[model samples]
Target: MDNNGPAYHEMMELHEILNFKTLCLVKSKMMSGLVFDQDLKALMEKDVKQTTAAIQDLQSVYKPNGGIVH
Candidate 1:
Protein backbone atom coordinates (compact mmCIF):
# COMPACT_ATOMS: atom_id res chain seq x y z
CA MET A 1 0.00 0.00 0.00
CA ASP A 2 1.09 3.57 -0.56
CA ASN A 3 2.71 5.23 2.43
CA ASN A 4 0.50 8.33 2.06
CA GLY A 5 -2.77 6.41 2.18
CA PRO A 6 -3.40 6.57 5.92
CA ALA A 7 -2.59 10.24 6.20
CA TYR A 8 -4.78 11.01 3.22
CA HIS A 9 -7.68 9.09 4.73
CA GLU A 10 -7.31 10.83 8.07
CA MET A 11 -7.26 14.25 6.39
CA MET A 12 -10.33 13.38 4.36
CA GLU A 13 -12.17 12.25 7.47
CA LEU A 14 -11.27 15.44 9.27
CA HIS A 15 -12.51 17.49 6.32
CA GLU A 16 -15.79 15.60 6.33
CA ILE A 17 -16.30 16.15 10.05
CA LEU A 18 -15.60 19.85 9.68
CA ASN A 19 -18.14 20.07 6.89
CA PHE A 20 -20.72 18.29 9.02
CA LYS A 21 -20.10 20.56 11.95
CA THR A 22 -20.44 23.61 9.72
CA LEU A 23 -23.77 22.33 8.42
CA CYS A 24 -25.04 21.64 11.93
CA LEU A 25 -24.03 25.07 13.11
CA VAL A 26 -25.80 26.71 10.18
CA LYS A 27 -28.93 24.66 10.81
CA SER A 28 -28.92 25.52 14.46
CA LYS A 29 -28.65 29.19 13.64
CA MET A 30 -31.55 28.94 11.23
CA MET A 31 -33.70 26.99 13.65
CA SER A 32 -32.97 29.37 16.46
CA GLY A 33 -34.79 32.13 14.52
CA LEU A 34 -34.32 34.50 11.64
CA VAL A 35 -32.70 36.86 14.11
CA PHE A 36 -30.72 34.40 16.31
CA ASP A 37 -29.29 36.32 19.26
CA GLN A 38 -26.16 38.33 18.54
CA ASP A 39 -23.92 36.46 20.97
CA LEU A 40 -24.87 33.03 19.70
CA LYS A 41 -24.63 34.11 16.11
CA ALA A 42 -21.21 35.60 16.75
CA LEU A 43 -20.01 32.41 18.37
CA MET A 44 -21.29 30.26 15.53
CA GLU A 45 -19.76 32.57 12.95
CA LYS A 46 -16.42 32.42 14.74
CA ASP A 47 -16.49 28.65 14.85
CA VAL A 48 -17.39 28.43 11.17
CA LYS A 49 -14.62 30.84 10.23
CA GLN A 50 -12.07 28.94 12.26
CA THR A 51 -13.14 25.62 10.81
CA THR A 52 -12.98 27.02 7.29
CA ALA A 53 -9.50 28.34 7.93
CA ALA A 54 -8.42 24.97 9.28
CA ILE A 55 -9.70 23.20 6.15
CA GLN A 56 -7.87 25.66 3.98
CA ASP A 57 -4.69 25.15 5.94
CA LEU A 58 -5.03 21.40 5.59
CA GLN A 59 -5.52 21.73 1.86
CA SER A 60 -2.43 23.87 1.62
CA VAL A 61 -0.45 21.37 3.64
CA TYR A 62 -1.59 18.53 1.40
CA LYS A 63 -0.71 20.36 -1.77
CA PRO A 64 2.19 18.97 -3.79
CA ASN A 65 5.55 19.92 -2.25
CA GLY A 66 3.81 21.42 0.80
CA GLY A 67 5.63 18.82 2.89
CA ILE A 68 2.95 18.11 5.50
CA VAL A 69 2.60 14.42 4.68
CA HIS A 70 5.61 12.17 4.71
Candidate 2:
Protein backbone atom coordinates (compact mmCIF):
# COMPACT_ATOMS: atom_id res chain seq x y z
CA MET A 1 0.00 0.00 0.00
CA ASP A 2 1.30 3.48 -0.89
CA ASN A 3 1.90 5.50 2.31
CA ASN A 4 0.43 8.70 0.94
CA GLY A 5 -3.06 7.31 0.35
CA PRO A 6 -5.85 8.28 2.78
CA ALA A 7 -5.78 5.15 4.88
CA TYR A 8 -7.17 5.08 8.39
CA HIS A 9 -3.96 3.78 9.96
CA GLU A 10 -1.91 6.40 8.18
CA MET A 11 -4.16 9.17 9.42
CA MET A 12 -3.94 7.87 12.96
CA GLU A 13 -0.16 7.72 12.74
CA LEU A 14 0.03 11.28 11.48
CA HIS A 15 -2.17 12.46 14.31
CA GLU A 16 0.01 10.67 16.84
CA ILE A 17 3.15 12.20 15.37
CA LEU A 18 1.75 15.73 15.57
CA ASN A 19 0.58 15.18 19.17
CA PHE A 20 4.00 13.84 20.19
CA LYS A 21 5.72 16.88 18.70
CA THR A 22 3.41 19.22 20.61
CA LEU A 23 4.02 17.38 23.84
CA CYS A 24 7.78 17.56 23.35
CA LEU A 25 7.66 21.31 22.81
CA VAL A 26 5.55 21.89 25.91
CA LYS A 27 7.76 19.70 28.06
CA SER A 28 10.96 21.37 26.82
CA LYS A 29 9.63 24.85 27.58
CA MET A 30 8.45 23.83 31.03
CA MET A 31 11.83 22.39 31.87
CA SER A 32 13.69 25.52 30.75
CA GLY A 33 11.65 27.93 32.87
CA LEU A 34 11.47 31.60 31.86
CA VAL A 35 14.62 32.55 29.98
CA PHE A 36 13.81 36.28 30.25
CA ASP A 37 14.09 39.05 32.81
CA GLN A 38 11.16 41.08 34.17
CA ASP A 39 11.14 43.57 31.31
CA LEU A 40 11.29 40.84 28.72
CA LYS A 41 8.59 38.92 30.50
CA ALA A 42 6.32 41.98 30.38
CA LEU A 43 7.05 42.45 26.68
CA MET A 44 6.30 38.79 25.96
CA GLU A 45 3.09 39.00 27.94
CA LYS A 46 2.00 42.03 25.93
CA ASP A 47 2.74 40.27 22.68
CA VAL A 48 0.84 37.20 23.82
CA LYS A 49 -2.16 39.31 24.78
CA GLN A 50 -2.17 41.00 21.39
CA THR A 51 -1.86 37.70 19.54
CA THR A 52 -4.63 36.19 21.63
CA ALA A 53 -6.91 39.11 20.92
CA ALA A 54 -6.25 38.77 17.22
CA ILE A 55 -7.10 35.07 17.33
CA GLN A 56 -10.30 35.79 19.24
CA ASP A 57 -11.27 38.35 16.65
CA LEU A 58 -10.83 35.82 13.88
CA GLN A 59 -12.68 33.20 15.86
CA SER A 60 -15.59 35.55 16.42
CA VAL A 61 -16.07 35.70 12.69
CA TYR A 62 -16.36 31.91 12.42
CA LYS A 63 -17.68 31.03 15.87
CA PRO A 64 -21.30 31.06 14.69
CA ASN A 65 -20.41 28.24 12.35
CA GLY A 66 -19.98 26.25 15.56
CA GLY A 67 -18.12 26.62 18.84
CA ILE A 68 -14.75 24.92 18.94
CA VAL A 69 -15.22 21.27 19.83
CA HIS A 70 -12.17 21.12 22.07
Specify the highest-TM-score model's number.
1
Measured on C-alpha atoms, candidate 1 has an lDDT of 0.62
lDDT of 2 by residue, 25-50 (tens): 45544544564576666665565565
Q: Which ten residues in a row have the lowest lDDT in candidate 2?
A: 61-70
Each candidate structure's TM-score, on Cα atoms with residue i matched to residue i, is: 0.46, 0.41
Clashing pairs for predicted structure model 2, backbone only: none
Give Cα distance to truth, residue 29, candidate 2, Å.
Answer: 0.6
The per-model lDDT (C-alpha) reads 0.62, 0.50
Displacement of the residue 33 alpha carbon in candidate 1, Å: 7.3
* Candidate 2 wrong stretches, greater than 4 Å: 1-5, 34-70
